[model samples]
Target chain A: MFIEFKDVSFKYPNNDKNVIDHLSFTLEKGSMLAILGHNGSGKSTIAKLIMGLLKATSGSIYICDTLLDEKSIDDLRQKMSIIFQNPDNQFVGVTVKDDIAFGLENHQIPRQEMLEKISKYATLVDMMAFLDANPENLSGGQKQRVAIAGALAMETELIIFDEATSMLDPKGTKEINAMIKKLKNEHNKTIITITHNLEEALFADRVMVINDGKIVLDGSPQEVLKEQTILEASGLKLIDGIAIIKEIEKTSLLSKENKEKICEALWELTFKM
Target chain B: MGINFQNVDFKYAKKASHKQLDNVSLNIDEKDEFIAIVGHTGSGKSTLVQHMNALLFANSGNITIFDTKVVRNKKIKLKPIRKHVGLVFQFPEYQVFETTVLDDIMFGPKNFGKTTDLAKELAIKASQLVGLDEELLTRSPFTLSGGQMRKVAIAGALAIDPDILILDEPTVGLDPKGKIELMELLLAMQNKTHKSIIIISHDMNIVAKYTKRIMVMHSGKLVFDGSKEALFNNEALLKEYNLDLPTAAYLAKELKAMHLIDYDSLPLTKEELTHIILGDSCNE
Candidate 1:
């Protein structure tokens, strides 16, 4: 496994209860995985654990077959890049271009080559027009684009989005979602997304539903979201495709089997629409 | 008028600025209605909402909240105007500065000149509105769960007893249950106080299901304003704004196109869609 969570359990420092408990999962290389759950479900906790921001209390996590430890921590981060929820919190540079170059600078890439990478990423996220803009001047979504450009420049093998879309508007939300899909499809990089917008997960190859510090459901959106009762119990509802399924199921015009096929076809229809 | 924006344009204080609000005009009725202002990032949605309470003044044009225009008006006091309009910034937990939950929530009321006794009463009531257990009143706000802390901050806004409440991305970063509970509490508050509520959000599905009046912004322009149905019907407008129609609204349109459902009616929720699909004759 490129990344594996082996029955890992974790608690924030000094906290008695584990935020992530008995969590075991695997991410194959180049597969975009969506992690879904409500607040306090330990989804973000799982992200922090993978990013080496928190230590696990039990079990083990392996990234690229390497055990996590202080000696390997820096190297681990070098290969894994994470985009946090708050765009402002992650910005380390003054201007968009400088910000994109921050990571490359840390990696000790020369200025000349780093400039090329920064420009490339800026264009990739459609922030080329704002390359010289101050980070604080940009809106949340614009700032996030810069953050994503910075992360993309790192070209990390595994990318995790910790509710990165929460602050963006609908168009901004779609823009970033498309970027994630592009990364997975064209770049051959593994992706992990923690989001409440289950609609965004339609294109994802796999999704894991976590709750109460444990993964409650593990499957495709078809396997999980098709069951509205299960989703609602977890404070979620069917998103795009599954929503169509539920709608068609109500009509009684289509059999349960047809409903599934139509739901499966939502992606194709959405693209054409 | 509950809120009004006229030819309002604002650029954030820094340079290399994307115009946050550009030549936008809007009018919100005095009817105690639930309104949602939704747009993608850099769409001027926040700029418009902030203008409601004078947190960010318009660079040009006028802003009127309630009956009085927000200028150097001698007739209406700005302090009282601010007290009448309470604004809750996003991730409100970060604004918690008091030692305890009760004290934090009471800060606004006390600052607005309510007695400590009255402030405490209001705090307790506000906490209940947001579904916080009273035992947490004495607990440190810093130590509470993220969801609980958000409720505490929202309760802070509630303490002022505002006539109008504007929340900027109030539901962001919350789990769905927390988001729904908060929304329900706000709805309850709206019922009890008859206060006007404005929610600034980017999520179309949320806006579709919750608000009575919908406003769409893009490129700092107020692109569309009307009912949720109208907003969804204007696919060209929604597309021009770079926003996706709410999946329900979008799917309903598709089903209508396919002759699978009613073309004129847009279903806002899954339950409604189910009713339409199953021919249950029950309105969800």
Candidate 2:
């Protein structure tokens, strides 16, 4: 496993209860995982813990087969990058080109290599045209694309998006989703997306639900989302395609075989459209 | 009576070439109105709503809110107009700065020149209206949950007793259930007060389920304004405005394409779509 958590638990200094309660999970290299949960469900906490922003109260975490401790923290951090919910808060440079270069320069990359990497990742995110544009002048979608370019320019193996699309409109959300797809399939980057938007999770290789700091449901996206009652209990709803199919199943008007065929077709059409 | 806008045009600065609001005109009643303004990002939805409260004056044309007229280069008392039209910004919870919830709720009333005692009375009433627990009113607003903090911020707006209440992207970061609960709370508030309620949203599902009137803006232009049914039914208008259908309507259309279900009208909610599909099979 590229990332592993074993019986990890965390509690804030002032809070009595654990925010993450003995949670255990693993992700293989070059796979996309979607973490779904409601407000205060510990989904964001897991991301922080993995990124070494917060120390785990108990248990162990391993990154690239090395234990995550204070001694190895700096080494592990170099292999990961995180894009937060607000694009404005994360920007450190005045221009898009400077922002992407900020991360590359911190790692002490030579000036020539930094420029090449910046242009390459900027073009990959479709932001090459806006490289000279000021971050303040760009739209929310454009700002997020610049953020993605910065993250990719670091060339980290693992990237985490923490509710990155919740602040955007549909157009912006769609743009980020396209980038996520490309990063997973073409670039083979390990991805973890923490979001409440169930529709965005439909394309994930694996989906997990967190309820009260515990992983209550985990499996393939289709398998995990099929548990309608469980999902609702965890403050989630099925995606529109699976939801329609479930409603169809309740009415006995269609045969079992026909229902199965319709389900497959509907699922395919959902993503295609 | 109500608020009226005539040929309103606004630009951010004198040198900026593009107008943020271009030749806009509309009317919103003082009572019993539920409307949503939607468009792509940077399409001027926020700029349009800011004008409702005199936060941004028009560079050209005029706005009549109740009886006060807002025109360029005219000096008038803007406080009364702002008092009658309350605007809650996006991520309102971030604006909560008072130590206690009650103090936060009372800020608006006090700012409008109400005495402390009267402000307290109105604050308590508004807190009750938003369904916030009385016990939580004394607790620090920082300690409350995200949803509760949002309710407290809304109560602050309600305490001012504006005839028209507007919210910008009120459910942006909330969960699915949280979104539904907040929308329902706003609906109940509208029913109880009979005041106009306008929200700026990007989620078509919320617009279709809760709001009656839908306004679409494109490049700072008011392209369409009418009922949800009319807006969703017009494919060319929706495409031109850069709007997408509600999930239920999209599902119904896809099912029709696969020759599974046919409907005379698109369903805006899952319940409506299920009813149409089941009703069709039963008739067959």
Chain A vs. true chain A, TM-score per candidate?
A: 0.89, 0.95
lDDT of each: 0.79, 0.90
Among these predictions, the greatest TM-score belongs to 2
lDDT tens per residue, model 2, A1-273: 899999999999988899999988999999999999999999999999999999999999999999999999999999999999999998999899999999988989999999999999999999999888899998888889999999999999999999999888899899999999999999999999999877888889999999999999999987887788899899986666778778888879766766776677767776665
User: Model 1 - which docking category?
Assistant: acceptable
In candidate 1 chain A, where is summed lDDT lowest over 10 consecutive residues? A264-273
- DockQ, each predicted model: 0.41, 0.64
DockQ of 1: 0.41
Q: List the residue pairs that clash in candidate 2.
A: none
Which clashing pairs does model 1 show? A39-B175, A169-B40, A250-B277, A250-B278, A251-B277, A251-B278
- Where is model 1 more than 4 Å wrong at Cα? A240-273, B1-31, B56-69, B73-76, B217-224, B280-284
True contacts kept of each: 0.51, 0.58
